[model samples]
Target: MTPVLYLDFDGVLHPADVRVTASEPKRPRVYNGGSTNHPLLEHAPLLERILAPFADVKIVLSTSWVRVLGYEYTMQQLPAALRERVVGTIWQGELLQHPPRTRYDAIQSDANNRGVTRWLALDDDTEGWPDEQRYALIAPNNFWYGLAQPGVADELSQALALLCAGKPLESRLPQETHVPSTVERIFGLG
Candidate 1:
């Protein structure tokens, strides 16, 4: 099976706190249908750099952008090269009143339905993920910069390398350790 990279956009591609007003008095911006006009869109290349080497890696959108912008437009927002790597999306237009308790549950539901065993989720929210799957997630401690933070992309790449090498989900790499501090573990900064 091809390894899937479950990707989120708001916090993963750019700053989650970036505010957008309906009226922009400052500058004339190229507006897509949705809020893909992030200043950090320039960081697309950084994501590409890490993902490029893993030819077997396929992308699966776990971002809400897919629902708002439409699948085709959301795919266009990504770099042209990465567009082809996109195989599918996690959300399928379901309007659940009470959505899955956490992002991990939603991703796992999709993964389970798709029969995807080899996969890693890159998201900012790390709530409710069990330790087994937590190792597979390369969550950003810094929401503003996401993977652009120093060493984050490298760590993500390394994790992908291990996954692509056929390592089981339960296997822990040398760099990975159980966080002793309660705060770090709770926030998934471990």
Candidate 2:
């Protein structure tokens, strides 16, 4: 079975602390992102290089951008190398009208519907992911810094290899500790 990589754009492709413009958002000054171009396109080469060896590996969009830009447009935004590897997105058009409780559940629902067993997810947010599913996630440094962090790419590469081998993907960093409810944020009640 071809391995599927669930990719997030905001934090995975570029830093989450980015500025949005009418044309294209401005990416923050990343530490080692290879390029200082648009945030979305800057880290394309890095992802390309990491997945180059795994030719059969496919990418499934797990980013909120898919809801706004649509799959075709989002695919077009990716680097040529990464674009060719994209199969589809986790968020189907209709589902956008009614999002799941968590990002992990959304991806899992899509993967299950597609019968995709061998898969991995890379993102900065791991909120709502159960412990078992957390094992497959390669959480980024933080929202502000992504693969720019030292050793991030190496860690991602290693995680990819392990996921491809069907081995458990343990979290090196702490899991999403806790996610407060919307009411808590709104009313300041825990």
Candidate 3:
């Protein structure tokens, strides 16, 4: 079976805009994002590259942004032809108000209803999954205002391979420890 792929906006697919915009009601040099067409929009080709190995996968979006706005707005970032390839969507309206225990559950529920298994989720906020099952690709900083680097999508693809083989994905940066040993380290954590 082709795995189901859960697509997210924000850091996973879209990059946070670090630039200040004139339309802002207040400040300058402030950034905004998780919405589509941020600079990370340049990275979308990564999605097509990552999903290529899966023969029958279905694409499902788990982004709350879509629900907050709507398809019309979301589609603005894509070329007309690219938008046509999207198959199914789960809007923010379809979700429970409190973030759930499984972003996987959200995706899995959609996959189950569609009778799909072998799924992959790409998310910035994986509020739905418990700590142990955080097997999907989670942005390292755990913040919404960043972007995935180029290799990340490849690692996510590798993780899907690992999961299908009944193995867990080790940190792609296994040698890189994130925890800080001192309070001074905490200051630079972001």
Overlapping backbone residue pairs in candidate 2 total 0
Please list the Cα RMSD from the true structure of every candidate, rounded to 1 decimal place. 7.7, 9.6, 9.3
In terms of TM-score, which candidate is strongest? 1
Question: What's the TM for model 1?
Answer: 0.77
lDDT (Cα, tens digit) per residue for candidate 2, span 1-190? 7799999987777777544345654322333345345445467788888898788889999987777667777788888888888898888855677899889889888888889988888887789989766667877866655765667788888878877777766644456666779998899886
Model 2 score (lDDT): 0.77
TM-score of each: 0.77, 0.76, 0.60
If ranked by lDDT, best first, what sequence of candidates would result? 2, 1, 3
Q: Give lDDT: candidate 2, residue 174.
A: 55
- For candidate 3, lDDT tens digit of each residue in 1-190? 6556677766665553323345741221224533333354555766666656654555666765555555556655554444544666655445545444666667766766767655666776555566555665545343443335645655677776775564545443355556666775777653
lDDT of 1 by residue, 55-139 (tens): 9999998886665556776788788878889998886745233457787888888888889999998888888989756887888
Worst 10 residues of 3 by lDDT: 25-34
C-alpha lDDT of residue 16 in model 2: 72
Select the stronger candidate by lDDT from 1 and 3.
1
Off by over 4 Å in 3: 17-40, 79-85, 92-105, 138-147, 162-190
